[model samples]
Target: MDNSVLRHDMVDGLEESLDRFPDAVSVAMRSVPRHEFVTDGPYQNRPTEHRKTNTTILAPTAVGRLLSALAVEPDHDVLVVGAGVGYTAAVIAEIVGDSNVHAVDITRTLVYEARENLQRAGYEGVLVDCRDGADGLPEYAPFDRILVEASAVKPPRRLLAQLADGGRLVMPMGVGEQTLVAIEDGDVAEKFGPLSFKPLLVDGEQTGSIVRNRTKREDPEYEGRGWHAGHGWEQDWIDWEAHH
Candidate 1:
């Protein structure tokens, strides 16, 4: 199939799935080349019916639907986690403008690929960093929007702390059966349909003694990653209670 034809088909699928955020969805679909973000594998050649493998590109419809739920704004300063191959980031770059998009991924290869793909698509102002998504980019703190591509048992406090007062965050929550959760003002304001994403993996391992000491010393309300530390739900619940 011609690349342009496939691109059009992907765009059409995005429009169909992202009916809610029409303008944002359309801008992303029209601007980002899906093929550039996908690998030349059996999955890319048969996206319509293919299930994504570990390295496969996410379905266009899924990406579009998630982006629609994010409710991004033109002036929003965005942070995208797990930005594989840069397709989603490129689309977001188009929607929020390149100057406002900052993306990070844990994999070095994915980072390189994303940078190349974004450049190929003529997208500028997107900064791709190879780092752990859970940690987030602190230097660019107080972002207007944050999107996480992977699922976590709980939302990371590091990521939440980076949100501006009114900033919004979209991420997959839960273990076996994940749901797309939207966080705003330290509360889960909206939830999309069920989604299954790979679990987030962070680096390093701390001893139980260290974890115990840290937990004891830290505020009871503050749960840094530690032994028997609760998931994102605990922190999210605390945040919600505090806000409410």
Candidate 2:
């Protein structure tokens, strides 16, 4: 089958499933070639987990739900927390120009592969860097829209602070039972529904890194290999209150 046809069929499947799939996001998803990121079953709706990278490439329905929650506008500065396979960024690039899209990943290998994949997908203008996802790309702070591909107990302070005035951010909120949440003005505006995703991780917690035995960061005693995050204890802390 033609890739374009496959893409359309994928979008059609999402539209039928979702209660209110945004037309813009549906169009963008259909426009981006997911095959550029995944070698197998690019149009499939099931998530393929990569244990090596400790990341899951979200299914198309999940992608549709995220973008619909993100509600990005053209030329909006958007930051994706987990670059993963770069398919989500490419889809967002179609909605907001590629140059306006920025992404970061804790896994160095995933960053390199994401950049290459975005380039192959004709979304090279999207900036992808290898860094702690919890840090929220400070140099490109103040984004109009922020999308976190991973789940967290709470929205990281850095990411919330980086949001432009009146900007919106969407992420899966929780550990065992996560919900797709939309945040604005530093508060949870809405909760889409139950969403399960891998927990948000810092530099040291990522796959293939040394185990985190110490709770506090020992900056002076250790060489600059692990614990690359600016703030440590915050990412470690858990917010117990459920969404009000």
Candidate 3:
């Protein structure tokens, strides 16, 4: 089937599963081409990882749920952490004006791909930057909303600090037990529900200098010791993790 039909079906499926999916979220999902983001088989609701960068385009349900919970407004300035192929960023751009969205990713490859994908999808106005998702786009600071695609043991302080006075930040929090946590007004945090997502990487890349800089060996012993499968950075980054 064509992408337009597929997009509609995906949104319909999401709305059928999630009763509270906002009309804005539904429209955004239906507009962005999932096929453009994932250069593979027919578009489906499941996650698809780009082999080159190891960046996974989140499943439709996950994206739908996260976007619905975010409740993005058309005029709001939004930041998308872990842009991947820029699908979420494009969706947000479709809701909020393209100029109102900024996306960041630590993996330079993913950043470039996201930019290319967004451009091809006619969302070139959406800013896709190559930077640590944790630091956020301080240059575009005080965002009205922030959506983190990766899971973290805890909320990153830098992200919380960058939120606008009454902004809302949504992210998958925890390792062994992960929950969707939303911090509204920067101080008031509420746990939504159990969520599973790939761990948020701070300074590691699947390839290139970032991966080369890692002194630790990738072994079974290092799995939960310093890094986690589902949630990256299990330990080590403690100052912010402990306090927040």
Candidate 4:
């Protein structure tokens, strides 16, 4: 019934199941109360849907993998794309200091939700913004680590550009069979797993959200595009006539 007990069990499960789960990351994960972010089954090591967001609160083991891949250090500036409920950012803030963590979510509703969740978790210093995740937080550029929760065919160049030298960017790559890959200096440094995640969204495709940056036409052709929705770019950005 106690949050601490649940958090403890969550971390214990992670350490048992994952190889090379970093000690620092586990300690940070243990310290954060994930229940503040996801009110349902916060310690289950399973993904849970965020209320009304169509986004998932990542499993603790997945969070453990990303944190370990990023290799975060104390005071490191970290950017988290797709800040679902803010749990991942809060956990990272525990290791990197709340002031040093920044996050972005394309859905405005989730952005507000994440902000509230972080504040309630005592991580009010972490900044969460509503914006397309591919456009990494440039104001906080040169981040020591960047983690993108959504899957993409390739890392967004903007996110890669925002990374500080010697920094790492960990994200799920590919559409059909995603691999959690870590990138350094524009190259893949490591790859792990065949995970499944929702496609990285663009400025206009966020679920339950109205078209942002209007004049950005609502995508009318997406229903026929099959499984690769958005594919990290807006439908209008491509010239269907020329490509076809």
RMSD of each: 8.6, 7.8, 4.8, 3.7
TM-score of each: 0.76, 0.87, 0.87, 0.90
lDDT of 2 by residue, 1-244 (tens): 9999988998999999998788899889888989989867889888987646657888998989899899999999999999998999999999999999999988888999999999998999999998878788989888999999888778988899999999999999876678999999988999999988776776566677864524433443442344333223244432323422
List runs of model 2 lying over 4 Å from the truth.
Answer: 213-244
TM-score (C-alpha, index-matched) for candidate 2: 0.87
What ranking emerges by lDDT with the best candidate at the front?
A: 4, 2, 3, 1
Measured by TM-score, the strongest candidate is 4
Stretches of candidate 3 exceeding 4 Å from the true structure: 210-244
What are the lDDT figures for the candidates, one per model?
0.72, 0.84, 0.80, 0.85
lDDT of 4 at 124: 98
- Steric clash count of candidate 2: 0
How does residue 216 of candidate 4 score in lDDT?
A: 39
Q: Candidate 3, TM-score vs. the true structure?
A: 0.87
Model 4 clashing-pair count: 0
Count: clashes, candidate 1: 2
